[model samples]
Target: EVVRQYKLGLARHVNEHTGRPLSRATQTYFLVALRSLLRYWAMQGLDVLAPDRVELGKAPSRSLKFLDGDQLRRLLDAPDINDLRGLRDRALMETFFSTGLRLSELARLDRDHINLRTREFGVIGKGRKPRIVFLSDAATNWLGRYLQARQDRWKPLFVRMKGKPDLAPGGPGMRMSTRSIERLVGKYVRLAGLGVKATPHTLRHSFATDLLSNGADLRAVQEMLGHANLNTTQIYTHVTNPQLRAAHRKFHSGNRE
Candidate 1:
Protein backbone atom coordinates (compact mmCIF):
# COMPACT_ATOMS: atom_id res chain seq x y z
CA GLU A 1 0.00 0.00 0.00
CA VAL A 2 2.86 2.41 0.78
CA VAL A 3 4.58 1.62 -2.54
CA ARG A 4 1.28 2.09 -4.40
CA GLN A 5 0.79 5.51 -2.78
CA TYR A 6 4.37 6.52 -3.60
CA LYS A 7 3.85 5.55 -7.26
CA LEU A 8 0.66 7.60 -7.43
CA GLY A 9 2.45 10.60 -5.93
CA LEU A 10 5.26 10.33 -8.45
CA ALA A 11 2.82 10.12 -11.33
CA ARG A 12 1.09 13.32 -10.16
CA HIS A 13 4.31 15.22 -9.48
CA VAL A 14 4.95 18.49 -11.26
CA ASN A 15 8.11 20.31 -12.19
CA GLU A 16 8.58 23.39 -10.00
CA HIS A 17 10.35 25.49 -12.61
CA THR A 18 8.49 24.42 -15.76
CA GLY A 19 5.08 24.16 -14.12
CA ARG A 20 4.53 20.99 -16.16
CA PRO A 21 4.05 17.38 -15.16
CA LEU A 22 7.26 15.58 -14.37
CA SER A 23 8.66 13.75 -17.37
CA ARG A 24 8.35 9.98 -17.61
CA ALA A 25 12.14 9.55 -17.60
CA THR A 26 12.42 11.67 -14.43
CA GLN A 27 9.70 9.63 -12.72
CA THR A 28 11.40 6.38 -13.69
CA TYR A 29 14.75 7.69 -12.44
CA PHE A 30 13.19 8.55 -9.05
CA LEU A 31 11.64 5.09 -8.78
CA VAL A 32 14.91 3.41 -9.73
CA ALA A 33 16.81 5.31 -7.07
CA LEU A 34 14.21 4.45 -4.48
CA ARG A 35 14.35 0.78 -5.47
CA SER A 36 18.13 0.76 -5.02
CA LEU A 37 17.80 2.24 -1.55
CA LEU A 38 15.11 -0.27 -0.64
CA ARG A 39 17.28 -3.11 -1.90
CA TYR A 40 20.20 -2.00 0.27
CA TRP A 41 17.94 -1.73 3.32
CA ALA A 42 16.40 -5.12 2.70
CA MET A 43 19.90 -6.65 2.43
CA GLN A 44 20.64 -5.21 5.90
CA GLY A 45 17.65 -7.18 7.30
CA LEU A 46 15.49 -4.11 7.68
CA ASP A 47 11.71 -4.57 7.29
CA VAL A 48 11.63 -2.42 4.17
CA LEU A 49 9.58 -3.12 1.08
CA ALA A 50 11.04 -5.55 -1.43
CA PRO A 51 13.02 -3.87 -4.25
CA ASP A 52 11.21 -5.94 -6.91
CA ARG A 53 7.92 -4.42 -5.75
CA VAL A 54 9.07 -1.02 -7.07
CA GLU A 55 8.28 -1.56 -10.72
CA LEU A 56 9.47 1.16 -13.12
CA GLY A 57 6.99 2.62 -15.54
CA LYS A 58 7.97 2.62 -19.18
CA ALA A 59 9.20 6.01 -20.47
CA PRO A 60 8.30 7.32 -23.90
CA SER A 61 10.89 7.27 -26.66
CA ARG A 62 13.23 10.25 -26.62
CA SER A 63 13.10 12.73 -29.48
CA LEU A 64 16.45 13.24 -31.16
CA LYS A 65 17.33 16.88 -31.97
CA PHE A 66 19.85 17.83 -34.64
CA LEU A 67 20.70 20.80 -36.85
CA ASP A 68 19.78 20.77 -40.53
CA GLY A 69 22.32 21.50 -43.23
CA ASP A 70 21.50 25.21 -43.54
CA GLN A 71 21.55 25.63 -39.77
CA LEU A 72 24.86 23.82 -39.57
CA ARG A 73 26.36 26.08 -42.25
CA ARG A 74 25.15 29.19 -40.45
CA LEU A 75 26.63 27.97 -37.15
CA LEU A 76 29.95 27.07 -38.76
CA ASP A 77 30.12 30.57 -40.30
CA ALA A 78 28.96 32.38 -37.17
CA PRO A 79 32.48 32.92 -35.85
CA ASP A 80 34.75 35.51 -37.47
CA ILE A 81 37.91 33.69 -38.52
CA ASN A 82 40.07 36.83 -38.45
CA ASP A 83 40.15 36.87 -34.67
CA LEU A 84 42.12 34.20 -32.80
CA ARG A 85 39.24 33.35 -30.44
CA GLY A 86 36.88 33.19 -33.39
CA LEU A 87 39.28 30.87 -35.18
CA ARG A 88 39.32 28.57 -32.18
CA ASP A 89 35.53 28.58 -32.00
CA ARG A 90 35.23 27.70 -35.68
CA ALA A 91 37.70 24.86 -35.29
CA LEU A 92 35.94 23.60 -32.20
CA MET A 93 32.57 23.57 -33.97
CA GLU A 94 34.04 21.86 -37.00
CA THR A 95 35.61 19.18 -34.83
CA PHE A 96 32.29 18.55 -33.10
CA PHE A 97 30.53 17.96 -36.42
CA SER A 98 33.45 16.06 -37.87
CA THR A 99 34.09 13.64 -35.01
CA GLY A 100 30.80 13.35 -33.10
CA LEU A 101 32.76 13.43 -29.83
CA ARG A 102 31.07 13.71 -26.47
CA LEU A 103 31.79 17.08 -24.80
CA SER A 104 33.94 15.55 -22.05
CA GLU A 105 35.93 13.44 -24.51
CA LEU A 106 36.67 16.51 -26.63
CA ALA A 107 37.53 18.58 -23.56
CA ARG A 108 40.17 16.03 -22.54
CA LEU A 109 42.01 16.19 -25.88
CA ASP A 110 45.66 17.17 -25.95
CA ARG A 111 47.55 18.78 -28.83
CA ASP A 112 49.48 15.58 -29.50
CA HIS A 113 46.37 13.40 -29.60
CA ILE A 114 45.42 14.40 -33.16
CA ASN A 115 47.35 13.72 -36.36
CA LEU A 116 46.68 16.53 -38.86
CA ARG A 117 48.24 14.46 -41.62
CA THR A 118 46.08 11.43 -40.91
CA ARG A 119 43.00 13.38 -39.84
CA GLU A 120 42.16 10.78 -37.21
CA PHE A 121 42.50 10.31 -33.45
CA GLY A 122 41.43 7.96 -30.69
CA VAL A 123 39.26 8.94 -27.74
CA ILE A 124 38.15 7.23 -24.54
CA GLY A 125 34.38 7.48 -24.50
CA LYS A 126 31.79 6.38 -21.93
CA GLY A 127 32.59 3.10 -20.09
CA ARG A 128 36.24 4.02 -20.58
CA LYS A 129 36.05 2.36 -24.02
CA PRO A 130 38.40 3.63 -26.72
CA ARG A 131 37.32 4.38 -30.29
CA ILE A 132 38.89 6.03 -33.31
CA VAL A 133 37.35 9.32 -34.50
CA PHE A 134 38.05 10.76 -37.92
CA LEU A 135 38.18 14.41 -38.91
CA SER A 136 36.89 16.06 -42.08
CA ASP A 137 39.22 18.01 -44.32
CA ALA A 138 37.51 21.21 -43.30
CA ALA A 139 38.00 20.42 -39.62
CA THR A 140 41.63 19.63 -40.15
CA ASN A 141 42.27 22.88 -42.08
CA TRP A 142 40.49 25.03 -39.47
CA LEU A 143 42.34 23.25 -36.62
CA GLY A 144 45.67 23.77 -38.38
CA ARG A 145 44.96 27.47 -38.79
CA TYR A 146 43.91 27.81 -35.14
CA LEU A 147 47.04 26.02 -33.94
CA GLN A 148 49.27 28.16 -36.16
CA ALA A 149 47.81 31.34 -34.64
CA ARG A 150 48.40 30.29 -31.04
CA GLN A 151 51.65 31.56 -29.46
CA ASP A 152 51.56 29.55 -26.27
CA ARG A 153 52.57 25.89 -26.26
CA TRP A 154 49.61 24.78 -24.18
CA LYS A 155 49.29 20.99 -24.03
CA PRO A 156 45.52 21.11 -24.44
CA LEU A 157 44.11 21.11 -27.98
CA PHE A 158 41.56 23.74 -27.01
CA VAL A 159 42.19 26.34 -24.31
CA ARG A 160 40.51 29.35 -22.69
CA MET A 161 42.07 32.14 -24.71
CA LYS A 162 40.64 34.92 -22.52
CA GLY A 163 42.73 33.98 -19.45
CA LYS A 164 46.40 33.97 -18.61
CA PRO A 165 48.09 30.59 -18.54
CA ASP A 166 49.00 29.02 -15.21
CA LEU A 167 52.46 27.53 -15.69
CA ALA A 168 52.51 26.01 -12.18
CA PRO A 169 53.04 22.28 -11.86
CA GLY A 170 49.78 20.31 -12.36
CA GLY A 171 47.90 23.57 -13.18
CA PRO A 172 45.24 23.37 -15.88
CA GLY A 173 47.18 25.92 -17.96
CA MET A 174 44.39 27.52 -19.98
CA ARG A 175 42.74 24.15 -20.66
CA MET A 176 39.15 24.62 -21.74
CA SER A 177 36.57 23.22 -19.38
CA THR A 178 33.57 21.20 -20.57
CA ARG A 179 31.29 23.97 -19.27
CA SER A 180 33.15 26.56 -21.34
CA ILE A 181 32.70 24.46 -24.48
CA GLU A 182 28.99 24.13 -23.74
CA ARG A 183 28.67 27.91 -23.40
CA LEU A 184 30.71 28.46 -26.55
CA VAL A 185 28.42 26.21 -28.56
CA GLY A 186 25.36 27.94 -27.09
CA LYS A 187 26.70 31.36 -28.10
CA TYR A 188 27.13 30.29 -31.73
CA VAL A 189 23.72 28.61 -31.77
CA ARG A 190 22.20 31.99 -30.85
CA LEU A 191 24.35 33.93 -33.30
CA ALA A 192 23.25 31.65 -36.12
CA GLY A 193 19.62 32.34 -35.20
CA LEU A 194 18.78 28.62 -35.31
CA GLY A 195 15.54 29.33 -33.39
CA VAL A 196 16.12 26.02 -31.60
CA LYS A 197 17.97 25.11 -28.46
CA ALA A 198 21.16 23.21 -29.29
CA THR A 199 24.16 21.96 -27.35
CA PRO A 200 27.45 20.22 -28.15
CA HIS A 201 25.54 16.94 -28.00
CA THR A 202 23.21 18.32 -30.69
CA LEU A 203 26.17 18.45 -33.07
CA ARG A 204 26.91 14.85 -32.22
CA HIS A 205 23.34 13.99 -33.15
CA SER A 206 23.66 16.00 -36.34
CA PHE A 207 26.80 14.10 -37.25
CA ALA A 208 25.15 10.72 -36.77
CA THR A 209 21.94 11.72 -38.56
CA ASP A 210 23.80 13.27 -41.48
CA LEU A 211 25.73 10.07 -42.08
CA LEU A 212 22.68 7.84 -41.81
CA SER A 213 20.71 10.10 -44.16
CA ASN A 214 23.54 9.87 -46.69
CA GLY A 215 23.24 6.04 -46.84
CA ALA A 216 26.09 5.22 -44.50
CA ASP A 217 25.68 1.77 -43.00
CA LEU A 218 23.99 1.78 -39.61
CA ARG A 219 26.51 -0.56 -37.98
CA ALA A 220 29.39 1.62 -39.23
CA VAL A 221 27.79 4.72 -37.69
CA GLN A 222 27.36 2.70 -34.49
CA GLU A 223 31.12 2.20 -34.40
CA MET A 224 31.92 5.85 -35.15
CA LEU A 225 29.57 7.15 -32.46
CA GLY A 226 31.07 4.72 -29.90
CA HIS A 227 27.70 3.39 -28.81
CA ALA A 228 28.03 0.38 -26.49
CA ASN A 229 24.92 -1.13 -28.00
CA LEU A 230 23.53 -0.93 -31.55
CA ASN A 231 20.09 -0.15 -30.10
CA THR A 232 21.33 3.27 -28.99
CA THR A 233 22.43 4.03 -32.57
CA GLN A 234 19.06 2.83 -33.94
CA ILE A 235 17.31 5.91 -32.53
CA TYR A 236 18.58 8.05 -35.42
CA THR A 237 16.89 5.72 -37.97
CA HIS A 238 13.52 7.33 -37.30
CA VAL A 239 14.91 10.68 -38.39
CA THR A 240 16.02 9.21 -41.73
CA ASN A 241 13.00 7.02 -42.33
CA PRO A 242 11.12 9.73 -44.24
CA GLN A 243 13.98 10.11 -46.69
CA LEU A 244 14.06 6.37 -47.21
CA ARG A 245 10.32 6.35 -47.86
CA ALA A 246 10.67 9.12 -50.40
CA ALA A 247 13.46 7.31 -52.22
CA HIS A 248 11.43 4.10 -52.33
CA ARG A 249 8.46 5.93 -53.82
CA LYS A 250 10.62 7.57 -56.46
CA PHE A 251 12.77 4.61 -57.45
CA HIS A 252 10.95 1.42 -56.55
CA SER A 253 9.64 -0.60 -59.55
CA GLY A 254 6.26 -1.04 -57.85
CA ASN A 255 5.67 2.72 -58.18
CA ARG A 256 6.11 2.57 -62.00
CA GLU A 257 2.47 1.46 -62.49
Candidate 2:
Protein backbone atom coordinates (compact mmCIF):
# COMPACT_ATOMS: atom_id res chain seq x y z
CA GLU A 1 0.00 0.00 0.00
CA VAL A 2 2.86 2.34 0.74
CA VAL A 3 4.43 1.58 -2.63
CA ARG A 4 1.11 2.23 -4.38
CA GLN A 5 0.76 5.57 -2.57
CA TYR A 6 4.31 6.52 -3.46
CA LYS A 7 3.65 5.77 -7.12
CA LEU A 8 0.57 7.99 -7.04
CA GLY A 9 2.62 10.76 -5.43
CA LEU A 10 5.23 10.48 -8.13
CA ALA A 11 2.54 10.74 -10.80
CA ARG A 12 1.49 14.10 -9.41
CA HIS A 13 4.97 15.33 -8.58
CA VAL A 14 5.87 18.63 -10.28
CA ASN A 15 9.18 18.96 -12.08
CA GLU A 16 11.28 21.90 -10.92
CA HIS A 17 12.95 22.27 -14.25
CA THR A 18 9.92 22.19 -16.61
CA GLY A 19 7.34 23.42 -14.07
CA ARG A 20 5.07 20.53 -15.04
CA PRO A 21 4.11 17.13 -13.74
CA LEU A 22 7.02 14.68 -13.71
CA SER A 23 7.18 12.69 -16.93
CA ARG A 24 6.52 8.98 -16.82
CA ALA A 25 10.15 8.25 -17.77
CA THR A 26 11.40 10.46 -14.95
CA GLN A 27 8.99 8.77 -12.56
CA THR A 28 10.27 5.40 -13.68
CA TYR A 29 13.85 6.55 -13.07
CA PHE A 30 12.96 7.61 -9.54
CA LEU A 31 11.09 4.39 -8.86
CA VAL A 32 13.95 2.30 -10.24
CA ALA A 33 16.45 4.06 -8.00
CA LEU A 34 14.19 3.57 -4.98
CA ARG A 35 13.70 -0.10 -5.88
CA SER A 36 17.47 -0.62 -6.07
CA LEU A 37 17.88 0.94 -2.62
CA LEU A 38 15.10 -1.23 -1.26
CA ARG A 39 16.77 -4.32 -2.69
CA TYR A 40 20.06 -3.32 -1.08
CA TRP A 41 18.31 -2.89 2.28
CA ALA A 42 16.60 -6.29 1.93
CA MET A 43 19.97 -7.90 1.17
CA GLN A 44 21.23 -6.45 4.48
CA GLY A 45 18.31 -8.21 6.31
CA LEU A 46 16.28 -5.01 6.77
CA ASP A 47 12.50 -5.41 6.53
CA VAL A 48 11.44 -3.62 3.35
CA LEU A 49 9.01 -4.07 0.51
CA ALA A 50 10.22 -6.28 -2.35
CA PRO A 51 11.57 -4.39 -5.36
CA ASP A 52 9.26 -6.40 -7.63
CA ARG A 53 6.27 -4.86 -5.86
CA VAL A 54 7.15 -1.48 -7.35
CA GLU A 55 5.48 -1.34 -10.75
CA LEU A 56 6.72 1.19 -13.28
CA GLY A 57 4.28 3.28 -15.25
CA LYS A 58 4.29 3.02 -19.01
CA ALA A 59 6.46 5.69 -20.63
CA PRO A 60 4.91 7.80 -23.36
CA SER A 61 6.06 7.35 -26.93
CA ARG A 62 9.08 9.40 -27.87
CA SER A 63 8.57 12.50 -29.96
CA LEU A 64 11.38 12.95 -32.47
CA LYS A 65 12.59 16.32 -33.74
CA PHE A 66 13.92 15.97 -37.27
CA LEU A 67 14.14 18.19 -40.34
CA ASP A 68 11.98 17.36 -43.32
CA GLY A 69 13.32 17.33 -46.88
CA ASP A 70 12.80 21.04 -47.58
CA GLN A 71 14.09 22.08 -44.18
CA LEU A 72 17.13 19.82 -44.55
CA ARG A 73 17.95 21.26 -47.96
CA ARG A 74 17.68 24.78 -46.61
CA LEU A 75 19.86 24.02 -43.62
CA LEU A 76 22.47 22.38 -45.86
CA ASP A 77 22.50 25.51 -48.01
CA ALA A 78 22.75 27.85 -45.01
CA PRO A 79 26.56 28.02 -45.18
CA ASP A 80 28.28 30.25 -47.71
CA ILE A 81 30.13 27.58 -49.70
CA ASN A 82 32.37 30.05 -51.48
CA ASP A 83 34.19 30.88 -48.25
CA LEU A 84 36.64 28.43 -46.59
CA ARG A 85 34.88 28.31 -43.21
CA GLY A 86 31.53 28.01 -44.94
CA LEU A 87 32.84 25.15 -47.05
CA ARG A 88 34.01 23.34 -43.90
CA ASP A 89 30.66 23.94 -42.19
CA ARG A 90 28.78 22.58 -45.21
CA ALA A 91 31.00 19.49 -45.20
CA LEU A 92 30.45 18.95 -41.48
CA MET A 93 26.67 19.24 -41.81
CA GLU A 94 26.65 16.98 -44.84
CA THR A 95 28.69 14.35 -43.03
CA PHE A 96 26.37 14.45 -40.02
CA PHE A 97 23.29 13.83 -42.17
CA SER A 98 25.04 11.25 -44.29
CA THR A 99 26.55 9.12 -41.54
CA GLY A 100 24.05 9.52 -38.68
CA LEU A 101 27.11 9.66 -36.41
CA ARG A 102 27.02 10.91 -32.85
CA LEU A 103 28.64 14.36 -32.34
CA SER A 104 31.57 12.82 -30.50
CA GLU A 105 32.07 10.15 -33.15
CA LEU A 106 32.20 12.77 -35.90
CA ALA A 107 34.51 15.03 -33.92
CA ARG A 108 36.94 12.18 -33.26
CA LEU A 109 37.50 11.46 -36.96
CA ASP A 110 40.86 11.94 -38.66
CA ARG A 111 41.72 12.45 -42.34
CA ASP A 112 43.23 8.98 -42.58
CA HIS A 113 40.09 7.43 -41.07
CA ILE A 114 38.08 8.21 -44.23
CA ASN A 115 38.51 6.73 -47.67
CA LEU A 116 37.31 9.12 -50.37
CA ARG A 117 37.25 6.45 -53.07
CA THR A 118 35.17 3.96 -51.06
CA ARG A 119 33.17 6.63 -49.23
CA GLU A 120 33.02 4.42 -46.15
CA PHE A 121 34.93 4.05 -42.89
CA GLY A 122 34.79 2.36 -39.51
CA VAL A 123 33.95 4.26 -36.32
CA ILE A 124 34.01 3.29 -32.67
CA GLY A 125 30.59 4.37 -31.44
CA LYS A 126 28.75 4.03 -28.12
CA GLY A 127 29.87 1.21 -25.81
CA ARG A 128 33.17 1.09 -27.70
CA LYS A 129 31.47 -0.82 -30.49
CA PRO A 130 32.85 -0.55 -33.99
CA ARG A 131 30.52 0.01 -36.96
CA ILE A 132 30.95 1.10 -40.56
CA VAL A 133 29.76 4.55 -41.65
CA PHE A 134 29.21 5.41 -45.28
CA LEU A 135 29.46 8.84 -46.83
CA SER A 136 27.09 10.19 -49.43
CA ASP A 137 28.42 11.52 -52.71
CA ALA A 138 27.59 15.04 -51.63
CA ALA A 139 29.46 14.57 -48.35
CA THR A 140 32.42 13.15 -50.21
CA ASN A 141 32.46 16.04 -52.68
CA TRP A 142 32.23 18.72 -50.00
CA LEU A 143 34.86 17.01 -47.83
CA GLY A 144 37.24 16.70 -50.73
CA ARG A 145 36.81 20.37 -51.56
CA TYR A 146 37.34 21.41 -47.92
CA LEU A 147 40.45 19.25 -47.54
CA GLN A 148 41.90 20.40 -50.83
CA ALA A 149 41.45 24.04 -49.87
CA ARG A 150 43.30 23.51 -46.60
CA GLN A 151 46.60 22.87 -48.42
CA ASP A 152 48.28 21.80 -45.17
CA ARG A 153 49.04 18.60 -43.27
CA TRP A 154 46.24 18.36 -40.71
CA LYS A 155 45.61 14.93 -39.15
CA PRO A 156 42.19 15.94 -37.80
CA LEU A 157 39.39 15.65 -40.36
CA PHE A 158 37.93 19.00 -39.32
CA VAL A 159 39.94 21.84 -37.79
CA ARG A 160 39.47 25.45 -36.73
CA MET A 161 40.29 27.72 -39.65
CA LYS A 162 41.63 30.40 -37.28
CA GLY A 163 41.98 30.50 -33.50
CA LYS A 164 44.69 29.44 -31.08
CA PRO A 165 48.37 29.48 -32.01
CA ASP A 166 49.46 27.07 -34.73
CA LEU A 167 51.03 24.19 -32.80
CA ALA A 168 52.21 21.76 -35.48
CA PRO A 169 51.06 20.87 -39.01
CA GLY A 170 49.36 17.77 -37.51
CA GLY A 171 48.39 18.49 -33.93
CA PRO A 172 45.22 17.62 -31.95
CA GLY A 173 44.85 21.28 -30.87
CA MET A 174 43.74 22.11 -34.39
CA ARG A 175 40.83 19.65 -34.20
CA MET A 176 37.34 21.08 -33.76
CA SER A 177 35.73 20.21 -30.45
CA THR A 178 32.22 18.68 -30.15
CA ARG A 179 30.95 21.91 -28.50
CA SER A 180 32.23 23.93 -31.44
CA ILE A 181 30.36 21.59 -33.80
CA GLU A 182 27.18 22.05 -31.75
CA ARG A 183 27.49 25.84 -31.97
CA LEU A 184 28.18 25.60 -35.70
CA VAL A 185 25.03 23.56 -36.20
CA GLY A 186 23.05 26.05 -34.10
CA LYS A 187 24.33 28.96 -36.14
CA TYR A 188 23.13 27.36 -39.38
CA VAL A 189 19.85 26.36 -37.79
CA ARG A 190 19.18 30.02 -37.07
CA LEU A 191 20.41 31.18 -40.47
CA ALA A 192 18.14 28.68 -42.24
CA GLY A 193 15.17 30.04 -40.24
CA LEU A 194 14.03 26.45 -39.69
CA GLY A 195 11.67 27.70 -36.92
CA VAL A 196 12.42 24.47 -35.11
CA LYS A 197 15.05 23.69 -32.51
CA ALA A 198 17.72 21.45 -34.02
CA THR A 199 21.20 20.23 -33.28
CA PRO A 200 23.73 17.85 -34.79
CA HIS A 201 21.64 15.01 -33.37
CA THR A 202 18.69 16.38 -35.33
CA LEU A 203 20.63 15.56 -38.47
CA ARG A 204 21.13 12.04 -37.20
CA HIS A 205 17.38 11.81 -36.61
CA SER A 206 16.79 13.23 -40.06
CA PHE A 207 19.17 10.66 -41.52
CA ALA A 208 17.34 7.74 -39.93
CA THR A 209 13.91 9.13 -40.80
CA ASP A 210 14.92 9.89 -44.37
CA LEU A 211 16.12 6.33 -44.90
CA LEU A 212 13.07 4.73 -43.26
CA SER A 213 10.68 7.01 -45.15
CA ASN A 214 12.35 5.93 -48.37
CA GLY A 215 11.85 2.23 -47.50
CA ALA A 216 15.10 1.43 -45.74
CA ASP A 217 15.00 -1.50 -43.29
CA LEU A 218 14.86 -0.76 -39.57
CA ARG A 219 17.59 -3.29 -38.71
CA ALA A 220 19.83 -1.79 -41.37
CA VAL A 221 19.31 1.63 -39.82
CA GLN A 222 20.17 0.17 -36.42
CA GLU A 223 23.49 -1.10 -37.74
CA MET A 224 24.22 2.16 -39.55
CA LEU A 225 23.51 4.21 -36.42
CA GLY A 226 25.63 1.78 -34.36
CA HIS A 227 22.83 1.36 -31.79
CA ALA A 228 23.62 -1.12 -29.00
CA ASN A 229 20.06 -2.39 -29.13
CA LEU A 230 17.41 -2.57 -31.82
CA ASN A 231 14.92 -0.94 -29.43
CA THR A 232 16.93 2.30 -29.52
CA THR A 233 16.63 2.40 -33.31
CA GLN A 234 12.92 1.55 -33.17
CA ILE A 235 12.14 5.03 -31.83
CA TYR A 236 12.48 6.37 -35.38
CA THR A 237 9.75 3.99 -36.54
CA HIS A 238 7.12 6.21 -34.91
CA VAL A 239 8.12 9.00 -37.26
CA THR A 240 8.09 6.72 -40.30
CA ASN A 241 4.82 4.90 -39.58
CA PRO A 242 2.70 7.72 -40.93
CA GLN A 243 4.59 7.57 -44.20
CA LEU A 244 4.04 3.82 -44.31
CA ARG A 245 0.32 4.35 -43.78
CA ALA A 246 0.24 6.85 -46.61
CA ALA A 247 2.01 4.43 -48.90
CA HIS A 248 -0.39 1.67 -47.98
CA ARG A 249 -3.34 3.97 -48.65
CA LYS A 250 -1.97 4.78 -52.10
CA PHE A 251 -1.02 1.26 -53.20
CA HIS A 252 -3.38 -1.13 -51.41
CA SER A 253 -6.04 -2.59 -53.69
CA GLY A 254 -8.61 -2.78 -50.87
CA ASN A 255 -8.15 0.83 -49.83
CA ARG A 256 -11.52 2.50 -49.28
CA GLU A 257 -10.39 5.88 -47.98
**What is the C-alpha local distance difference test score of each model?**
0.73, 0.74
Off by over 4 Å in 1: 1-64, 169-171, 230-257
- Candidate 2, clashing residue pairs? none
User: Per-residue lDDT tens digits of candidate 1, residues 1-257?
Assistant: 88889889988987665578865644554565577667667778999888778787653435326777888889999999998999999999999988789999899998888888866677778766666676776788899999999887778889897767688753456789999999999999889998778899888877765655443444555567776643443323113234333432332221232
Quick one: best lDDT, which candidate? 2
Candidate 1 residue-wise lDDT at 29: 45
Model number with the top TM-score: 2
By summed lDDT, which 10 consecutive residues of candidate 2 come out lowest?
248-257
Clashing pairs for model 1 are none
Candidate 2: stretches off by over 4 Å: 1-64, 230-257
- Candidate 2 lDDT: 0.74
